[model samples]
Target chain A: MKNIRMKVARTEMDLSQEELAKQVGVSRQTIGLIELGKYNPSLNLCIAICKTLSKTLDDLFWED
Target chain B: MKSFFQRNKVKDERITNLQNKIYREIFLIVAAICVLSLIIKQLNHGYSEANIWTEAVILLVSSFYYMIRSTGLGIFSAEVELHNQASKRSMAFKNIVFGLLFGIGIGTFFGIRSAVLYADSTLQSIYYFLLVSLVSFIIYIPFLIVVVGITYLAAKKRSDRAVEKELEDDQDQDEHK
Candidate 1:
């Protein structure tokens, strides 16, 4: 499923996909794919994104 | 924006290096085959063959060219980095597995055919079958390795180009925004 939490947080922070991708050291397409649920980001990448967004893994990746 | 361009430039260089390596390697391999053919012809005293001198000259020239061309390339001079390593690795692994399976099928088919069609006795048939299988395996595995290796390099180049294009597009979009 799409990471709705990531979308919500990114929009909240007003960070574009490219900006987040750059901060996470991945291609924008990778970030887009992850957001769209077309690709699964690795655990390292998840952590990177969490760190960049100043959120915990449980907040962004974990589903209730 | 600037980082995207820089990353793509580095990736493009790596891909170009890989592409050149693939071409050089394949050229050398083909040249080697030609040389081997020439040597076998020479050993057999040009018997049952048409014009050994012509073949030898062609092979010699081509082999020299490939050797020189391959030497000109700076392969593995530095550690190569690939952005799409995971997908490329997965593709290469799949190609090798499929190539091996296909090779086995071909080897088995030829072994069975030779054993059944050309043998004088049951014992001779079994020996021929095993021999054929072993020889075919030896030949097929390397052949598949070369084929798959070239394919992997070509796929890598394509993906790298795609990434560059994507980065350029993203830059343009950002500038407009």
Candidate 2:
């Protein structure tokens, strides 16, 4: 499964990868890897990231 | 399986490397001491001191026993750096204990020989006491230093781990809040 692209959500919130990862309890490298499709964040991490970005999981993580 | 520990491969490798280094150092020291003892015997008494070779042989055999016992744990056991901090500490403690034993054994051997040859128990007793103290201190003091150093570093590592765990816990609580 793929998460919906986070670039748009992050841009909407004006948050950097560092800011998002800190808010999501993950390293910045985790954020970078997620964005680059190198790693898939867990469902919990996805939810956390979405919450921090003020986006619903459906908005940020649902690919279809 | 991706356990919490599995995430830190670098840390694991570093720990293994440390254990292997310690093992190698211990092996070298034991080997060197045995060789030195043989050299001393050869120099002082010629090849007639074949029994010193026997002592060297025993040292080699015991070293083998230790290696075999340790190796069953893993490859890193073949060297010093691979041992866990606790294992290293225990080894240090064991070394100090054994060093004292060796000192006493040597002193007693010499003391008994002197008493038998000279029939002077008082002189032999004094000689044994002095030799035992000297040998024991010589063997144990350096190892005591190493034990102290290793203990300090191990404590530091443990504290660092505790701090990291606390940070992780705080982050978890904050995320929940």
Model 1: per-residue Cα lDDT over B47-143, one tens digit each:
4457466766777787555434432331111011223332555555676788888788878878998898899999999999999988998899779
Model 2 agreement with the true structure over A1-64: per-residue lDDT tens digits: 3233686687567777556765665654456556655566667788888788887878876666
Q: Please report the TM-score between candidate 2 and the true structure.
A: 0.28
Native-interface RMSD of candidate 1: 7.3
Q: Which stretches of candidate 1 lie over 4 Å from their true place?
A: A1-64, B1-89, B171-177
| Per-candidate count of clashing residue pairs (backbone under 3 Å) | 0, 17
- Candidate 2 docks at the CAPRI level of incorrect
Give the best candidate by lDDT. 1
Clashes of 1: 0
